[model samples]
Structure formats: structure tokens, C-alpha cells
Target: MSLGSSKELAENKIILLYMIDKVNMPVSNHHITKLVLENKFMNYFILQQFLNELCDSGFLELSENGGKSFYSITPNGKKTLEYFVNLIPFGIKSIIDNTIPEIRSDIKKESLISADYTPKSENEYIVSCKLKEDNFTLIDLCITVGTKSDARTICENWKNNPQQIYSEIIASLTRKRDKTNRDKDKDED
Candidate 1:
């Protein structure tokens, strides 16, 4: 959703700043949407609008190659994030305190799975397992892996048979161990 006006856009920047501070990394629009939804603070439209504003204001960078857009915090964005980190504690303390009860209730209803677990649904599982360090999700992971193929393979296996996916992931990592050892040996030589 597009942000309504300059004023609303400013509010979104504040929220995005808070999000960066909370997550400590570049966040994509998808991650921001999840946080907003999870916290019951705003809708997806507003979140997207806010992100666009931040991008326009030189506070964030958006990459376009992947299915998910990646947003990295700029130096200016970092400054804004820092300012909000300090400001929010006191400015919104009362509101935050009041919201805790509801937040807790929502948290109880939302299912959180670990990175290691296979997801029941393809979309839900990918959304859940994607790395959240800064604002990136599984879609970002797919982009970084250089193709949707790897992500699709993993997702397909995960959905069709979780056990098989787990075994494959384990085997893939085990193969990487030997490669790592070889790289280390070359370095030593």
C-alpha cells in the first residue's frame, strides 16, 4: 500500500527506524509487513508505503533482482533508527505498556517455528524459515542463493516430505564440510 501523505510517511520512517533498531539489520518490505502484522500495529499497505518513503528519502536501498525486494539501511537511516531507539522508550511507553497484553495474546496464537523445522505449507514454511537478521526473509535467502531453483527444491521437498528435506539439508551441509576442509588445507599449503 502506498503511504498517504508526507505526514504519514514520516510516521512510517519512525516505525521503520524502530524496526531496524529492534532487528539490527537491513530489512525487506516483507519482513516489515510481518512485524507490523504480528504486532497488530499497521496494515501491509501502510508498511509498503512507509518503505517506499524511506527508499525515496535516501534512508534505505531497494534491490530489484529477487522475488522479494531487499532494503538495506543507509547511514541516514541508521541515524534515524538510533534516534528512535532512544526516543521510543519514553515517548510511547504508556502505549507500549498497554499493548503488551494484546501482543502477548497474539503471540500465543501465531505459530513460530525454528529454522531447522520443515514447514507444512510451502508459502507459510518459506516465510517462517527465512532468516530475519535485519529485515530479510526466506525470499531474500533465495535471491542470495542465486536462483529460485534451490529454494524451490527445498520447499518442494519440505512440503512433500519433511523427513526427506531434512536428510538432504544434512547431506548438503556434510558435503560442505569436506569442501571447507579442502579450502583450509589449500590455505595452509
Candidate 2:
């Protein structure tokens, strides 16, 4: 499909809207681009242009968090999609449907675990790691390290092993003191 044709352009826009609406959540641009490109639906530049145009025309809303752009369908976008979804080819729609579950899983995982680091001084840095669900933060851990490399390593480790780390931390914090050791200490005293 060539971009010069208005019909093809409109269909592409509808395709974008349909994907976002069906996904039923705020989807990051990176996720959308990956889906579209992996399916050979469009090239990177064209996909980006369509996204910007959609936002400009009130068809989609853009929100940014943690340096990632998330797109969600606006009411107008949903209405327009409802009217024009037929323009999108059945094969394309099928592909999108097949991929939605994986996309949802990825988005959920991405949103749940987050880590970042900022420099506090020439030799000091603070790393923040979080586990969140919806708007609730289950854990927000901050650690200060003496070097940028250490901060970066901590952030990377947190992202890669958040569940294990969270479990370990919880276990350590909640573990009961050894009763035998306490009794022995009392006896010694």
C-alpha cells in the first residue's frame, strides 16, 4: 500500500486506532512500534507520523512516564474507529488480535518493575527501584552507592531480578528472631 493514496492512509490510521482500542490500555510507543513493525504493517517513520497525527486530530492521547510515551485512544478516537474499523483488512485485524495477549503481558510486566538512578554528587548516586500495580506502589526502594557504576549495576539488577529481590527483602524484614539464641543469651546473663 502506497502512502500517496488517501484511502490507504485512512486505512492505516484506522488500523492504528483499532490496535490501540482493542489493546484496552495505555500502550507505550515502543510497544506499538514493535507490534506494527514485527507484523510488517508499516515502517518506523510512518508509524510515528500516524501516531502524532492521531494525537493532533484528537483521535489518540499521549502520556509520558519514565521517558516512555504511552498512547491511549480518546473518546473521539474510539468513535472514529468504530466507524472506520472495517477499512482495516481482516488479516491485519486477525494478526493484531493474535498478538494482544502477548502485548498485554509485556505492558503489565514493564509497568510493574521500574528502576532508575540519579547522581547525587561526583562520587555519590541514588538508585530507586519500584514495584507497582495500577496506581499503587507495592514497594519503592532507594539505595545510595558511592559510584555511578555501582548505581547502574544496582538499577540493572533490580530490573532483572525484582521479584527475587523483593521476596528476599520481605523475608529478611519479616523473619522472627531465633528463640534458642535469645534463651541462650538470657541464660548466659
Candidate 3:
């Protein structure tokens, strides 16, 4: 559908807010930028301008966490967007609805567990891992290893069983603490 410059920008902003509102979790900037690109919402320059305006106007909540930008619709944004969502073309709305599930699953998987590696020297690397929920990372760990293969192994293992590794670590530490306390008590007695 065709729209005037003013109407186009407004509808695009509404579309953004609508996407944020409909999604159960915050939408990352990458995801939003991709959407804008795939659907030809506007040029990157205009998209950025609208994004900033929305944030400055309190229509969008922009947060940075885990080195990523995530956007959510503020209450005012939702309230304002409610009035304008219908203004978006039905085709766009349908596309948004169709696209959300894939986006949601991808975000969910990535946010739950993540791993990365950086080379510190010719033979050493640092592997970073994170376990996250709702913008909060329950676990963030970095380990230095001897080789890229070692780092890759750790990253892969962490991504596969982060929760299990976390639980085991906590449990082992607690058990050791409890045993130490018991030994101290016995010696005193």
C-alpha cells in the first residue's frame, strides 16, 4: 500500500510499537532492523530517526543489556499505538503476525544460553558464557583455556547444559561448605 511521508513514518512507528507489544519478550534492535529492512518500512536513516524519536518521546523503552539493544513499548506507547495500529496496512499486520513466532523462538533460544570466545594470544583464548532470563543473566562466566579447540568445546558444552553445570557447581560448593562446618563442629565438641 502507498502512503504519504508523514503517514508512512507514523504507521511504521506504530508497527514497531505493535510488534513490541505483541511479543512476550523485548525485541532486539537487530530483529527490528531486520523487519524494517525485509518489509521496506523506510530507509535506514529514517528508521533510525523514528527509533530515536520514539525513545525520546517515551513511546519506546530502549535498554542495553548483554551488549545488545532491546526495545519494548512503554505504556504510553501501547496506548498511543492502539489508536494507530489499525492505520497500518492489513498486509503489513498479517506479515508481522506471521513473522513473530520465528522471531520469538530464535530470541528465546539465544537468550537462554550463549557462548563466545575471544583470542587472547596465539595459543590462548577466553570463553564467555551466559545464562539469561528476562534481560537478566543468571550466570555470566569467563574461562581462559589453552587452545581454540578447548575454548570451542567449553562454549559448546556451556550452550548445551548451562543449567546443569550451574546446578552442579552450586551444589558442590554448598556440600563442601556444609562438610567443612560439620568437621569444625566435631572438632570443637
**lDDT scores for all predictions?**
0.54, 0.92, 0.85
Candidate 3 or 2, higher lDDT: 2
Q: Which candidate is the best by TM-score?
A: 2
Q: List the residue pairs that clash in candidate 1.
A: 1-45, 25-134, 27-135, 130-138
Which segments of model 2 are wrong by more than 4 Å? 178-189
Candidate 1, poorest ten consecutive residues by summed lDDT: 108-117
State model 3's lDDT: 0.85
**Ranking of predictions according to lDDT:** 2, 3, 1
Q: Give the TM-score of candidate 2.
A: 0.87
Model 2 poorest 10 in a row by lDDT? 1-10
- Per-residue lDDT of candidate 2, residues 158-189 (tens digit): 88998898999999899898999889999999
Off by over 4 Å in 3: 1-4, 120-122, 130-143, 147-189
RMSD of each: 12.8, 3.7, 7.2
> Which RMSD does model 2 reach against the true structure?
3.7
Q: lDDT score, residue 77, model 1?
A: 84
lDDT of 2 at 41: 92
How close is every model to the real structure, measured as TM-score? 0.46, 0.87, 0.70
Give the per-residue lDDT of model 3 (tens digit) for 1-189: 443587777888898888878776888988888877898867777778778999999999888877999988898998898788788899888988998898898789877899999999999899998888777878888889999999999998888888899898778877745688889999999
In angstroms, the error of model 3 at 180 is: 30
